[model samples]
Target: MSSVTSSSVSLPQGFIPVMLTPFLESGEVDYDGLKALTDLYLEAGAAGLFANCLSSEMYELSAEERLKVTKTVVAHTAGRVPVVATGTFGGPVVEQAQFVKRIYDTGVQAVIVITGLLAEEDDSDEIFIRRTKELISLTEDIPLGFYECPVPYKRLISSEVLAELLPSNRIIYHKDTCLDIEEVVRRIQVAEGYRFGLYDAYMVNAVASLNAGAAGLSCIQGNIYPELIVWICENYNNVERQEEVKLLQKFFVDSMDIVHSAYPIIAKYCLQKRGFPISTYTRREVGELTGNLQERADQLLEDVDRIQTELGIASVFRKTLEVPLK
Candidate 1:
């Protein structure tokens, strides 16, 4: 490992927004659409922005496209808040290292390293861990966060090994998304102190994670509804927000149940419907949002409006947040 030291942690503690990539008609990237989405999230009270990850459909874009997207987002964000880009998978250690180095020069606040590209059953922890260590060494200058996702592409970092890697401040923030609640609780028991901050990646498990000592969330829903996310993080510990949190949780379940079925496809489609500009229908292979998926999205859109009114958030903005579905 290189003896490079990490810089002081400056990333916002909670409510990091995972941005959705807006595409063009011919499947080209919509840089203008990206700027509009960035402005929307910033205005919606996002503490930070996460780009080119799952939410941004990083895997679908070409290397050059990824760089351009990251550069455009950083420029659009205009330093209003922190921007964390994903530099986890690009094949071989050298390529991953080069990818990390390229974005590091773009001035992102940090990078979130995915364990491996393969689903959990396909890859061993040894390969993932070794790559993580290598990537960490290469990215010694810019701080990195470990993304702990679930099975079928899972890279759930064990608390024990995570502790071992903890000494290197290169790994500062972690997005806790292990589907196993018991595992998350157990890990939280091990991770303590202000130096290591954890953010919830799942909406349903977020409350428990918050109670279990997660600093806050880096939410996918924040891509569509940011004010609600801001309220939860700021009021996560407050007794008054408990009821509101429950309502938000219900909204999350209702929304995610629909959106996640098609994933980035449905996500981008919803954003486009809401008058939030997007260049394309969806990312590659993920396909366009339609059929039963379209119906489900419509139902959820209506529900979100009702829930927003119930939570007294509709009046928060002049133009109501719309996810107009057909």
Candidate 2:
């Protein structure tokens, strides 16, 4: 509510990366690196940014760090595009609502609710709906979204549950991790007239989801080769590019395991190799990048270049990153 606003018509489409938090070796948030990373995403053609997310290791960050991370992105963006952040950690509905308001005040267009953080795995949908309702009431009209974050536990909300919530006109975005195309379709079908969208995070069916009307993708793969993701989003349905699209889709399906191995570290490592000046440190305890994984990542980097060449697209980093560290 800082006078910053989203379309109210619909959320931004295409790549909305779940941002990674660059950290110093001493574990301090690297604001400078964060700024550079943000610019890289924009240069790569990201339609929006999802900061302070699970990819950003929201659980590991203190509330103060979360605010600062989000504020830095918002300030750096200076209204270039819509930005969203996870607003809920584990807490009561009221406390969660309070933090949502605080995050929205940081100038993000939407405050994302981590689904697992809202209810226990065994909790009834009725209980979950009630708490969500209470949160909506307490938070007023600030735009809200849902992330089926896997940390606490991924709570893939039912189409029934989503139907119940959309009438409020409060929920404007969804980061879907259901990994089910039919479920994604149901959510999009039900959101017909609302100012809301579902950005699919499961890349295995990225093109299928796009064809099914997903706003776009918000996935970890974007952390590694964001330009590739942007390329897919912009050309998912290009009939003439069907062959290239299928190949890219298969590449995503095959590379999923490796890309997820060392995670933000491997992602950062890959970025460093791409000539970006960002550290490979992570606060998530996702294990170190060992020799075997290192080789895989190195080979994967080569495959990325091949994909770029075959697709006739260039990595925006190559053009935007002016110098490489010796």
Candidate 3:
């Protein structure tokens, strides 16, 4: 119940960025770059941070490194906003539960459970549910969330599962990657009236999902321009801004491929172009941003500037880009 514990479980509204881990050219974790990146997201109106998630290359990071990454984010944030992180890597329930406690000890409001890690592709829901229950029980009363991580495989949780788990109250957040608005609505319905929220990861139907009563967005689109995502969340229902809102929604849909080409590399490149102190060097073997993809990224940068100007939002990377929150 302390400020650093359960209280942080109530993640704020608007964009909650799935943070990218910054690395030096030699591939060491660049703590300084990570801090600067954190500043950029906050300045762009991020309501919270999803550190140590897939975007942070959690798979490549060792146990100590994962804790270090999560701890770095927690310490740098200084409680400005809530932070959540993926706790369950692929392993036995008890082993995953132990890391959950360690991640929780890093002062995260909630430790996220990756759905794919809980059971195999061929595993039955009953099996997944049983293992999930075991993981929850072993973690005691610490808060938990689920990420529909598309690694190993994209193992989704049905609304039935939500109903089964909601009574526990320990599950407070969900990063929904199902990509179907109807499915998103179903999950939201099940989560209503609890201290729970479903953050949509798909940007194509973001407007529909938000108006359908989703808590907010947690998506890759935010990695490119966090402020724009914040703007959409703040103005999604504003009658006068409907035109602007629709324009940006279309941008999210159209720009998805270009922005996602090389993943955090493309995103990092976009930031570097804006003069941020980040490198495009990524630990993941995502191909380089060259040829057609590189061309699109360049064009996308131009489009981003144009859209930001028309939308009347400033780029978080201002001239000097010294940190301040939206």
Q: Between candidates 1 and 2, which one is better according to TM-score?
A: 2
Which 10 residues in a row give candidate 3 its minimum summed lDDT?
1-10
Q: Write the per-residue lDDT of candidate 1 for residues 45-78, one digit (tens) a residue.
A: 7888888777787878888887888889888888
Per-residue lDDT tens digits for candidate 3, residues 1-326, read 33444434567778899999988888889998888788888898898899998888889898999999999998999989888999998778999999899998898889999999999999999989899999988987888999999897999999988888888777888999998999888998988878888899999989998999888999987887788899998999999999999999999999888877889788887777776777777888878788787778879888989999998998878647533211
TM-score of 1: 0.87
RMSD of each: 3.7, 1.8, 2.9
lDDT agreement of model 3 with the native: 0.86
Off by over 4 Å in 3: 1-8, 319-326
Top candidate when judged by TM-score against the true structure? 2
Candidate 1, residue 176: the lDDT equals: 75
User: Sorted on TM-score, highest at the top, how do the candidates line up?
Assistant: 2, 3, 1
Encode model 2's per-residue lDDT on 114-226: one tens digit a residue.
88888899999998999899988998788899999888888998889999999888888899999999989999999898888899999998999999999999999998899
Question: Each candidate's TM vs. the true structure?
Answer: 0.87, 0.96, 0.95
Determine the backbone clash count of candidate 1.
4
User: Model 2: clashing residue pairs?
Assistant: none
* Candidate 1 Cα misplacement greater than 4 A, ranges: 1-5, 117-127, 149-152, 314-326
Look at candidate 1 and give me any clashing residue pairs.
Answer: 23-279, 23-280, 24-279, 119-153
Better of 2 and 3 by lDDT: 2
